[model samples]
Target: MRLPRFLLAGVLLAGSVLLLTELFAYRASGAVAFSIFTSVWLTLSIVNAGLGVFSAGYRPSEEAAALLPVFGLPAALAGVAWWAWPDGPTLPSPRLFWFLLAGLALWAAIALLAALLIPHATRETALRTAVAIFLPLWLALQVVNLLVGVLIENYSVAEELLILALNFVLTAAMPLAASRLAQRG
Candidate 1:
């Protein structure tokens, strides 16, 4: 999770944020919304990262390495939600709790699978590899998923946002657990 992984994560995050900015532009939220967004996101992400270094006893470099995926994924979900709906989404879609169930199940299954199957020496590398592979694919596939839901399924903004949130949780859980396992073992 150092040089190459850091570089890959950075590229992925920057590209996603750029796509988010574009999506915000596409929505009524405006380009100005993205400008304000990056400002707020940068400020919060930096402060949180700083807190991890100072209070949580995590290394600065590792915290920095983590910031992209930790924050960017949720933001990308929000962007897709915005693009899927004109007025934008509010918190907690009608079907949101179902995702909470599914996400937890996915987290457990993937973590268990990784623990059983992934080699101990390569857990970190495997985590990064999974993340690198999952990131782009998730975003691209979700775009199509959102479009289909919006156009034909007539999914509400809340429904779309909920799905995006579900996607975020499912994608993030394994990498998170793997990183922790790698750190400890």
Candidate 2:
């Protein structure tokens, strides 16, 4: 299950696109909206990276394994470009930044755990299992952000739906894309 270079490139590109979308969505909305979104993007990016790493482990090559985190670094740089530069938007507190990183670490750990568990499970079931566990936890965090008033901006329902759709496409489609690429290679 080693992923081909093109497939890895696709996954990285797709993940970067999704992260940029979140950053743009936040910038479009306002501060409260940005705050709420901050953690969500980090969580998803971490999970995406986690999944990539987990999937890469299937083939166990030093080259592929080395590329795992590199795939995610672009998104991080993108975030820094969008959020952390001088003369960029200032926020209520820096605490949210730390929280987002923590969330990402947590999700990354979960992905590693899922990767470890998958070997004992059937191949047919592992991807489904990973998705099942990931989506719920992700949604729940978003809901909590809204409930806690972190997402204070007035977002249209359509906007929410669009974000959800973008997230779904990125997370759900990645494995299929990787699977196809792996098979072909």
Candidate 3:
């Protein structure tokens, strides 16, 4: 599919997600909202990309190229905003770190399962398959890193500006990384 149309669809999906999540009071706090939003968005983006590969006969590279920017932009924005906000997002407890690590394996396994389900997609190189599968998944969690902008916590306006900047950077970077991964094989 053309990038513009694909992007429009992604935007629509994101908007719908935001609306529905809001209706459910998902944004009651930054942590809760980001978790809900990222989890849902990640699953949808990955499944959609996987479908393109399995059903539409698209290359892993093509799906990766389209998927990254389409999903990463808003995620990065929300992440940076969460960091810059004064109380700095009441993050999950440190004890949950192991759980997250386990979750990453689960994410990868699920992605691998998707590739396995589509026998044709499995013909692609391991790296290519991984890039397509994990790019969106990694991008989904991009908002989590917003916790690192320790200095920006006190500056709301600066945070907003950083959010915009980081969004652009991620929008550009994700596609570039995907393209790079696509090129590797």
Question: Which is the leading candidate under lDDT?
Answer: 1
- The lDDT-based order of candidates, best leading, equals 1, 3, 2
Report lDDT (CA) for all predictions.
0.52, 0.43, 0.49
lDDT of 2 by residue, 1-185 (tens): 42343234333333333333343344432333333334544454444455545764533355355445543444454345455432333334443443343334334334444443354654335444545665576556545444333346566656665555544444445545533454455
Q: Against the true structure, candidate 2 has what lDDT?
A: 0.43
| lDDT at residue 175 of model 1 (Cα atoms) | 59
Model 1 misplaced stretches (Cα beyond 4 Å): 1-121
Better of 2 and 3 by TM-score: 3
Model 2 worst lDDT window (10 residues): 2-11
Candidate with better TM-score, 1 vs 3: 3
Q: What lDDT would candidate 1 get against the real structure?
A: 0.52
Candidate achieving the largest TM-score: 3
Clashes of 3: 0
TM-score of 1: 0.34
Q: How well does each candidate superpose onto the true structure, as a TM-score?
A: 0.34, 0.33, 0.36
Runs in model 3 deviating more than 4 A are 1-28, 84-185
Residue 128 of model 1: what lDDT? 56
